[model samples]
Target: MPTMTAAQRRDLAKQEFDAFLADCPSRLVLDRISDKWVTLVIASLADGPLRFSELSRQLAGVSQKMLTQTLRTLERDGLVTRTVTASVPVRVDYALTDLGVSLQDTVRHLKTWAESHVPQVREAQEAYDRRAGQEVGA
Candidate 1:
C-alpha cells in the first residue's frame, strides 16, 4: 500500500483545484445564459426580437422581477440587445447577438439529450424518493 506525504497531498489538491477552475467556462457567455430562464429567453429571441411585454407573456410563471434581472444580465453579457423606441409612448425590445445565436445549437443539443432521458430520469427520481421514504406528492 502507498501513502501520500503532506507535500504530495497539497500538490494534488492544488492541481485538482486548478483543473476545476480551468474547466469552468468563462463568465462572459455562460454566467447569465447558464440559467434555464436566460437560456429560454435567448432561444425565444432566435425567431426574432421580442418586446418586454411579449417576452413576459411567452414565458409563463416567470415573475416580472426575475425577467428583468435575467434580461439585464443577458444584456451585460452581450448575449442580448436592448433597444428603446419612442412612439406614442416608450417601448423596449430584446434580440440575440451573434454570440447568442451561436448558443442555439448547444441549447438544442441539450434539449434533445434531456428529452431522450426523461423517462430514465423520472424513474430514477421515483426510485430514490421511495428509498428515502418520501411521498411522491398528491
Candidate 2:
C-alpha cells in the first residue's frame, strides 16, 4: 500500500474525531461531558424543560454559580438550549437540544449504574484498603 502525504494525513484526521488522541478536539467535549454537573444536569433535563430555580432545586448541593456555568458550557456545546420569555418576572428555561436528548439516556444509565453499585464499590474499596494496610504492616 502507498503511504499518504502529510496533507492527506491531516485531512483524514480532520474528518474523524478521536478522543484517544492527545490533541484531538473530542477530548474537550469528553472533558465537559464527564463533569459531574454535566451528567446531573443532562439527566435532570431529560424529564422536561425547567426554569433555573427548578433545575437548581432538583440538583441539591450545586451552587448557583456552578449551575450557571454548567448550563452556559452546555449551551455553548449545543447540548442544551436556553429559552427566555418576558413575564411578570423574566422567565428562563433550560431544555436539552436534539443532541442533548441523544446523550441523556446514556448519562441516565451511568447515574443509575453508579447508584445501584454503591455497595459493591464500597466493598471493593474496603478490601483494597485492608490489603494495603496489611502490606504496610508487613
Candidate 3:
C-alpha cells in the first residue's frame, strides 16, 4: 500500500468533516465559533493585540471567568495566541493568529447583521409574543 502525505491526510480528514452530522467534529468547532463571546473576542482582536484588561473593557458584560474561558478556547483552536510578557505586572496579551485574522471579516459581518436587524427581530418577537398570549388566553 502507498503512504499518504501529510497534505493528503489532511485533505482526507477535511472531506470527512460534515457539519450537518450530529456527531461531526466540525459541529463542535461551529458551536465554539458561533458563541457571542468568541465572536466579540475575535472582532475585538481584529485590529491589534489587546491585553486582558483591554479585552474585558472592550467586551462589556463579559464576566472575567467567561472571558478567560473564551480566550483559552480560542487559543486551543489555533485562532488566537496568548503571549505573556515578563513585566512588572506580568502582562498577558491576546492576538489573533493568521487563522483568526482570516475569520475577522466573517465575524464582523455577523455582528453587523445582528446589529442592523435587531429592530426587525424585535418586531418579530413582539408579534410572536402577542400570538402566544392570545393562544394561551383562547
Candidate 4:
C-alpha cells in the first residue's frame, strides 16, 4: 500500500461533514431543520410537551396538514418524541428528545435573530422593490 504524505494524513484526520458540499449528509439535516415549520415547532416545544391542538393554536398560521408533517418529520429525525394516552379520544403529546433539547439554544438564537432583523430585512426588500420598479419604468 502507498504511504500517505503528512498533508494527506492530516486531511484524512480532519475530515468532517461540510454542508456546502452537494452530497454531504449534513445538508439533509440542514434542510430539515431550516424549514420554517421545523424552526417554529422546535421553538414552541422549548417550554415542554404540547398536544397537537395546543401546537396548532400556538403556531398561528400553520395548517393541520403542515403541522402533522412537521411533527412526523421531527419525530422521524429523533429530535422529538410522541407520547399517547388513552382517553375518551386518544391524546397525543409531542416533546423534544435530548437531541432536540440540545438544539434549543441554536433555535432560540435563530428566532431571536429573525425577530431582531425584521426592520433591516424589510428595508432591504423595500429598497430592492423600488429599484426593480424604477428599472421596469425606465
- The local lDDT score (0 to 100) that residue 137 gets in candidate 4 is 100
Clashing pairs in 2: none
Lowest-scoring 10 consecutive residues by lDDT in candidate 3? 14-23
- Superposing all C-alpha atoms, what RMSD in Å does each candidate have to the true structure? 7.5, 3.3, 4.2, 1.8
Highest lDDT model number: 4
> Model 1 reaches what TM-score against the true structure?
0.73
| Candidate 3 local lDDT, residue 13 | 83
How would you encode candidate 3's per-residue C-alpha lDDT over 12-63 as one tens digit per residue?
7876797876778888888999999999999999899999999999999999
Which tens-of-lDDT digit does each residue in 1-138 have in candidate 2?
A: 789999999988775797777888888988999999999999999989999999999999999999999999999999999999999799999999999999988999999999999999999999999999999999
What are the lDDT figures for the candidates, one per model?
0.82, 0.95, 0.95, 0.96
List of clashing residue pairs for candidate 1: none
Rank order (by lDDT, best first): 4, 3, 2, 1
Better of 1 and 4 by lDDT: 4
**Per-model TM-score on C-alpha atoms:** 0.73, 0.88, 0.88, 0.90
Tens-digit per-residue lDDT, 16-122, candidate 4: 57676677788899999999999999999999999999999999999999999999999999999999999979999999999999999999999999999999999
Higher lDDT: candidate 3 or 4? 4
How many Å off is the CA of 10 in candidate 3? Answer: 14
C-alpha RMSD between model 1 and the true structure? 7.5
Which runs in model 4 stand beyond 4 Å of their true positions? 1-10, 13-16
Query: Compared with the true structure, what per-residue lDDT tens digits does model 1 show for residues 1-138?
Result: 589999999987777545247554454445555688987787778898999999999999899999999999888877889999988769889998898888878877776788799999999999998877755353
